[model samples]
Target: MSKQVIALAYDGRNAPSVTAKGDDALAEAILAIAREHEVPIYENAELVRLLARLELGDAIPEALYRSIAEVIAFAWYLKGKAPVGFGQRDDGDAPLLLSGPER
Candidate 1:
């Protein structure tokens, strides 16, 4: 069976960072790796909005750039086979119960 993938959104002051849904760290790492590889990145809605507020040819703020970088890194890590939940089946099956009982 295919695995369930989620879409992640980053809520920062400037750009609203969006990434492929996956483990937080993994996704960020993926984005970072992509950046390191010199891949072009696109801006999400939030980022566009923020950029729109600036004058043409204006430089982005440092804080906002840092936030964008972090979110991008996360997106990079998601490209690999990273598991979402703990103790769950890797094949996209439900987790097996080790112990269960009614209270």
Candidate 2:
């Protein structure tokens, strides 16, 4: 069976956003979108720290570009999908993207 692949986006500060694709197609689509928008992408703990300091409705800081990228990339990896751009999802898949290292 084909596993549901997903794509994720975020404001680089708040929670992650997610989307679904049939397979790796979603991940590729996400990369393309990021490239088109000239947005950097990232993955790992650095992403978490950067996202932590952001507040909803606050303006995105210029310095946080890399961090935002990392968060988006990480979200993709976590969901076994790809980075799309900047948005969030609330479906069952949402938890997977929002999940961080178990503390």
Candidate 3:
């Protein structure tokens, strides 16, 4: 399969949107920009195949909510960020489960 890359952006209040997508050389450029910006990179060939189907500026479909959420959550964890009010109260002491890197 040819190399591919997809980039997404999400605001807490709205669904995530596809900000970029490309194959081969364009894919390399996208990855380079992301690396320059220090954005987290997660590699999943299967997920890339699915996301590459989306148009630029398109919000992620409902069917992908869970998968996308997991990726976003992991990125947040890597950046040491938590959702607003998450684990803020004494009663909400749930620990975030960070797992081994996915291949």
Q: Rate residue 71 of model 3 by lDDT.
A: 89
lDDT of 2 by residue, 1-103 (tens): 2222223445434644443222245445545665575444443343444444545334336676565455545545655554344354432322222222322
Which model is ahead, 2 or 3, in terms of TM-score?
A: 3
The positional error of residue 21 in candidate 1, measured at the CA in angstroms, is: 28
lDDT of 1 at 48: 42
Question: lDDT (0-100) at residue 68 of candidate 2?
Answer: 49
Write the number of the candidate with greater TM-score, choosing between 1 and 2.
Answer: 2
Q: Global lDDT of each model?
A: 0.37, 0.42, 0.70
* Evaluation by lDDT, superior candidate among 1 and 3: 3
Of 1 and 2, the candidate ranking higher by lDDT: 2
lDDT of 3 by residue, 1-103 (tens): 4567788887776788888888877777777787787677887778777877889889889999999889888877776766777863221221111111222
TM-score of 1: 0.27
Error of 2 at 5 (Å): 27
Please identify which of the two predictions, 1 or 3, would achieve the higher TM-score against the true structure: 3
